[model samples]
Target: PGQVDFYARFSPSPLSMKQFLDFGSVNACEKTSFMFLRRELPVRLANIMKEISLLPDNLLRTPSVQLVQSWYIQSLQELLDFKDKSAEDAKTIYEFTDTVIRIRNRHNDVIPTMAQGVTEYKESFGVDPVTSQNVQYFLDRFYMSRISIRMLLNQHSLLFGGKGSPSYRKHIGSINPNCDVVEVIKDGYENARRLCDLYYVNSPELELEELNAVSPGQTIQVVYVPSHLYHMVFELFKNAMRAT
Candidate 1:
């Protein structure tokens, strides 16, 4: 019920939102082997079915809308595929949840780049400044929609993916100055340097170790979103790492 409620809150349209709550409306309801299982099964399964049934309606929509719809379609397909094949074991469930998080991460990595590319294309080819500005209205709406999707996926990954889930790591760590901010910070630094080298031709040394470590008297753990913190720190590292 909680999961279904979350979906309702995150759903794009309040009018169609009830489609997620009403399991009886799911198409091909005859496919389930037992009537009881169909009725008693997790509401999440029904929600996935609902999403699968509705996504096709967006096919003729704008390119950005289509991209988001396609992603949801594929993500739900993966969930269904995993549910059908797994034995409901802990390991199997973990792997399925991991795959879902990976899908969300991939979208996070791709969509921003896509938004930027589209924006750049419009500016480069637009006839006039006003025209480019006008086009930005639609682009802004498109990206806002994508951002909402990401936020929901991120929340879902954390709430349901459990302790071992990568999404859970985002909110359990503390500042690196403590020497115990976990290995993600180390990897983040390396990736930041690599990115700087690729773009700036000269990479600067990331003296992360020299930064003030959290004192023992202070709190050892800081609760926050890992991706948000990492991105900000990584960008700062890139700028500081650059050679003057």
Candidate 2:
């Protein structure tokens, strides 16, 4: 028998892209209070912070998904808009859209196209990208999740599992799973943090689904006071999407 630790085996993605880097003065006491702190805000200086923290989870995942979907839909329509030979490619992309959309809608029917694409993507990852863990046993849910590309969309950003590369890529090549380890871990941790915050600001007793929200188009303002050379902060800002 052998003892294995997920953390010991992997270097977590550098937290250079945390969502809370914009918070106001992080105080000593505040740091002491929180767990797995991305950052902490002093109650006194918190008002000086600009980035809006409270947004729904589904909504959080939505903005990027919507952006990519817009891109995909446009590419698909270009294939469809008006065409000769393009018509068939358009039709193919259209069928992909239909099949994917159906997968999203419900499972009375999952995918409508050839089990061909299914096999195509399956072999791409080759059972498990990690190649160490029995992927099916480790992620039965992962396999099930891909049943709908709509469900997978941005949710699985890392390709085949390139640490941090987009999970939704049809094929993702990895040089070192160790090198790419941080992205997936950071992503999941960030997600859990966001979900916890969303749940907390809404209701202490409510379930996550209960906290789901309609888009509240509220204006968010910012005022920055920089004190240091933060390559990390710059990187985080670039990585963090301005919600569309």
Q: In lDDT terms, which candidate is top? A: 1
List candidate 1 stretches off by more than 4 Å: 1-66, 69-113, 116-124, 134-148, 161-163, 166-187, 198-201, 207-221, 239-244
Error of 1 at 139 (Å): 5.3
Candidate 2 global Cα RMSD: 23.7
lDDT tens digits by residue: candidate 2, 24-138: 1223122221212111111101211111112222322334333433433343333222222332354543443343233234322322321333344354544444432432232
Off by over 4 Å in 2: 1-93, 105-179, 193-244
Clash count per candidate: 5, 10
